[model samples]
Target: MGVATTWHGTTILGVLRDGVVAVAGDGQVTAGDVVLKHRARKIRPLFDGHVVAGFAGAVADALTLFDKFEQHLKAWDGDLRRAAVELAREWRTDRYLRRLEAQLLVGDPGQLLLLSGEGDVIEPDDGVAAIGTGGPYAAAAARALLRHTGLTAPQIARAAMQVAADLCIYTNDQVTLITVPPERQEYEADDR
Candidate 1:
């Protein structure tokens, strides 16, 4: 959206295992066959709070959605699960949204949420979900991390970043992570 327009890809991933979650993305973004940029953070902090989101195309669109989603959440004092579901529902039925140019993966302190217009507010009981470049790889890594260690929020985020790092999927500055611990998750971003 600035000096760099490298935020498209086909390898973003996320995983949920043993009640823990980890999501990862590659550093490379492609527009058709051309790599547009590197080290972009597909995974991002939403509402500047505990909820996190990641996407794999049309960076601007994804960001716009996040902004509106966050505002809706705040406006209603909404729960993550319900808010996510509502957003997905809207995205799915709205005439204009029916053609969103990107895919979105959203998560918060209490649960992991994925919205693809296939369904909304889906809380994966299996403990995992993901979207974007290097997604499969990240999902695999998350499963491995979950199996080996019943990770906490920070641990999950760290694991996701580690997996993305190995694939040269992210840049040093582009990767960032945060978490919301169960009860304290709701006001996560604004807690400080």
Candidate 2:
């Protein structure tokens, strides 16, 4: 079943595999039955391109969260998990932020996380997650692809977003993607 979205139409998903992580989003903005815009980018690179993030909700609110999250990233010295957690805590406890209806999928080469206004910071067990109107379908498609095929992280993310667009009326095929590739030094013991 498709989830209900009042006016914000979006589908955002991410996948992590073999040291590669990617996030993808569909660009469709709707107001009830009306399609307002197409090609509205929802996926973006953050922290000097070290992290990637996607969002689903009111565009204004999502932008606000993005700015706040960026500050958290700076404060944490680019720690993805810590930045996400701080953002979640603020989103949940700050009354003004609590009223913002949005969800974030963020990651680096080594991790993928989901943050919500409910003070939740989640790391999917399978290194795949989704949010927005077509989130479930996209998530399921990514999981299936991950289990049955050897698609690269970006390929899997893009394909799953396409499936979501086909199934979710709120989503469209105009997809954008951002990825982080593995570096050899990241695997070194001293690097960790």
Candidate 3:
């Protein structure tokens, strides 16, 4: 029997700055050495648009994880960290979920987290996280931009994805970005 081929190719970056959180993802999908699609959206808004998530790995698996994470968010009342932790635990322990090959970067107004199938829920010290084939490249660029420039979270995320696209063949320039508004804004909108 031949081995099953896994679909790949994506770069997801999340940046938190000045009370804003932005997540960006590339639109490239690859199977083996072949480029399958461009303009594939890997970033999604969750928790009544108060949270943003991006994924890197098999498309189907990531989608499933997204749904699961959303359920956790609802259960936890939109708590980003709590939802991420629950997802990570289930992804690691559940027999069916353990086979999923994907990584997630999720953020809300107050937190940025990286979730893995290995039960890891990591929050970066600098409020920046990335995953996928070009993750390292994007993450490094994001850190530099965050430190040196006064760009907003979205701008930094976009720039970082661009840098990743330029360097990684698997990553493309077509980026989908989503942002979660600050906590104060959410409260203000509720009051209005």
Compared with the true structure, all predictions reach lDDT values of: 0.58, 0.87, 0.88
Where's the lowest-lDDT run of ten residues in candidate 1?
183-192
Can you give the lDDT of residue 54 in candidate 3?
A: 85
Residue range 41-70, candidate 2, lDDT tens digits = 887779988988889888789889999999
Arrange candidates by lDDT, descending: 3, 2, 1
**lDDT tens readout by residue for model 1, 139-158:** 66666776677665456645
Best by TM-score: 3
Provide the lDDT at 104 for model 1: 75
Which candidate ranks first by lDDT, i.e. highest? 3
Candidate 1 Cα misplacement greater than 4 A, ranges:
1-26, 150-152, 160-174, 181-192
Q: Residues 44-64, candidate 3: write the lDDT tens digits.
A: 789888998888887789899
User: Per-prediction TM-score, please?
Assistant: 0.71, 0.90, 0.91
Return the lDDT, model 1, position 7.
46
Q: Cα miss at 113, model 3 (Å)?
A: 0.2
